[model samples]
Target: MKAAEIRSKTVDQLNDDLASLKKEQFNLRFQKATGQLEKTARVKQVRKDIARIKTIAAEKSAGKKA
Candidate 1:
């Protein structure tokens, strides 16, 4: 998801997305451990997405405090 889209979401939604992404990241790690992952690059992409979502959430929270 794009930063703009993430920014539009409520905090609850972002938390949900973050949870789902973390679960996916865990599964990807397991797949990698078993040597079953098709594309290793997907792990990196998912990590970046998680970071982006967190960054947007933090920005929104900080804006609210100002």
Candidate 2:
């Protein structure tokens, strides 16, 4: 998801999204370890996406506080 899209979500939604992504990341790691993952690069992409979502969520919260 884009930062703009992420920023548009409510804090609660962002938290939910973050939780889901983290779970997916964990599953991906397990897949990688078991040699079941076909696309290893997806792990990196998911990590970056998770970071982006978190950064945007933080920025939105900070903006609201100011």
> What does the lDDT come to for candidate 1?
0.94
Give the candidate number with the greatest TM-score.
Answer: 1
What C-alpha lDDT do the candidate models reach, one value each? 0.94, 0.90
Give the alpha carbon lDDT tens digit for every residue of 1-66 in model 2: 777888788989999999999999999999999989998888998899899988888888899999
Error in Å for residue 62 of model 1: 0.8
TM-score, per-candidate, Cα-based: 0.93, 0.90
* Clash-forming residue pairs, model 1: none
Clashing pairs in 2: none
